[model samples]
Target: MTQQSLVSRRLSSRATRTFALVSVLFVTPFIATSSANAQVYTRAFGYASTEPGAFPTDGVLNDPATEDGALPARLRRTTVALTTTEAPGTIIIDTGNTALYYVLGGGRAIRYGVGVGREGFTWSGVQTISHKAEWPDWHPPAQMIKRQPYLPRFMAGGPGNPLGARAMYLGASEYRIHGTNDPSTIGKFVSSGCIRLTNEDVTDLFNRVNVGTKVVVLPKNGPHIAARELGPAAAEISVRPGLTPARPAVVTQRAGRQAMNIPVSSAQY
Candidate 1:
């Protein structure tokens, strides 16, 4: 994330302008709360006092539109199949199930579908938001530029920019949780590697998180299949059993199954 934009830390003039001159009685109060959107994006996953954030990176991506579909809808309503309580405003990106979670206080979690890196770009790590931006102009990294010279140096924030609406810059790395123009690709194994969230969903999450939030990616926390749905694939694996995480709706790299195959052998019972 670039140095703090003047608009950051406080509500943007646009937001004020949008709500200004309102005739409603509760208008003033609403504006006060609206400042939250102006603040930087942070991760507050109910941790003690504080700890150093992981996956920190720098550099800005295009400003993504804050339209909608960015929040973790299902995660907001997930039921804990087993024990363990998720903290308030906690974020869980389950790549296995293509879901993102927004911990809402109680033991429940809001799960939203997500698109992750294809088989090769897959990885797991912890990090916090070191920067936040809205309508941020995007400049493809040197590598992306070299690969595609036709790419523009900077793309202003808008619907077309690859960096959809909102972006949370991870600690100090090139990684980020940002929105995308291609909504269809979401909830699938795609992208260079960064976690892709719906434009609407990212916007919602942007406002909820802060500049120092924690992000923990599990083995297969965001797969499309629930524990029950895994029956078919689980049985298909002829090697060893699949990775049996204590959680559900997760599909990870199983010990027995190969990446090229989708667990469809019938030699073993």
Candidate 2:
């Protein structure tokens, strides 16, 4: 073959190879996305929502401020060691470390990143998930309203509202384990007194938790030996009921002195 013709053919072949590689690169993500959608990673605590593309679009739960944001992998939901005798379905909040654990028995728990109270606003105590709500309405308590007059007196549940997707009210003290519109606040010390999880994380915990789920909040500066030692957990287990247990004396007094009387609200935006 003429050298010119040979050169042209070689160039064409190289171009074709390049095109094929580019094509695969372009299509791979879509294929992976399809597979991901089909086989969503089920979260612990029986979270019904799937991962990857599962952000809600409803006005109440989809906060535009955090639409594109993501929680750090460390803060995202994962099963980890939680060596507690607490029965499965119990909720434990490690406020100092910004982690929440949903005990699943068998020495495992689902840990989620959380935002806790700032300084004097912090509190610790045993509380029950007295109530659960999806897209719950927000009523700025008299105290919160006085602090932020610009905040609406009563905002119906929606995307921008402080409460993101789910709420697990903490007994009669007005604290709650709730989702936040501002996901950036996760893993920080910035709430009034309630524990804040990302919308997705809280929704997962909400699905598995019941009204009477015991919530133990470790005090700021309290020892979180188990939560700190946790690594990834293996195998899936169903939530089972066991003995209703006593409070660990180790976690009792962390928030005892600082437990404030703040009324329940969405979260501090």
Candidate 3:
């Protein structure tokens, strides 16, 4: 081969290698970004925590107008099949599934997304809705206060309270079926030991069940079918991290009688 041709060939080889390296550099970031987006969009299970700075504008409980913005659509109230043998009016909490089902009979049940007790705090078994309250007060127990010193000793019932709209005491245990100001916590296991629902859902449930309603909490390995069905398509609300105070319900003081629209903040267990 001619000396000039040999030099030209070496230059061509170097040029090819340089082009390949440049192509890889440009494509790698896009691939990584696509993978991250896929993970976020295709997440079908619960979240560790809500996205920060997520909250309703008015800070009210269960304001239909505002609730849609704060909570994901899939996590909101839904109706599903009840394959269990439990009777009607029974309140069933599937902790493993992070869902609560109100048996409506005929193989149907109204389901609600919920936040169950964290790891060591979880429990299961039968209980009764021995008591129910609307806009219930929250007096954090001594133990809870010790664990979360930032928590208030007593939180009055109203908008911005941690225990959203309503609460139902579960027998004599420290736990209660209640509402949470943080709707983002739904479908997660972050609560101390209580079952939490959206304020709107709790109020709807509170009105339906009396003090003596039967409450059956399923075990961790319990029979549940909802989790397998829920997916990103169902989760319309995006999860926001950080603790933003939930919006409050609109209340009007008229004739010295306060007529309050439904929405709750937090409850104590």
lDDT agreement with native, every candidate = 0.50, 0.64, 0.64
RMSD to the true structure for each prediction, in A, is: 21.1, 14.9, 13.6
lDDT of 1 by residue, 195-264 (tens): 7776655665677788877776666543332321112211222222211111111112222211111111
Model 3 sits at a Cα RMSD from the real structure of 13.6
Q: List, residue by residue over 103-128, the lDDT tens digit for candidate 2.
A: 88888788888988876778777878
Preferred candidate (TM-score higher): 1 or 3 = 3
Query: Per-prediction count of colliding residue pairs?
Result: 49, 3, 25
Model 1 ranges off by over 4 Å: 1-86, 220-269
**C-alpha lDDT of residue 186 in model 3:** 75
The per-residue C-alpha lDDT of model 1 at residue 134 equals 70
| TM-score of model 2 vs. true structure | 0.62
How are the candidates ranked when ordered by TM-score, highest leading?
Answer: 2, 3, 1
Output the better candidate (2/3) by TM-score.
2
Model 3, position 138, has a per-residue lDDT of: 65
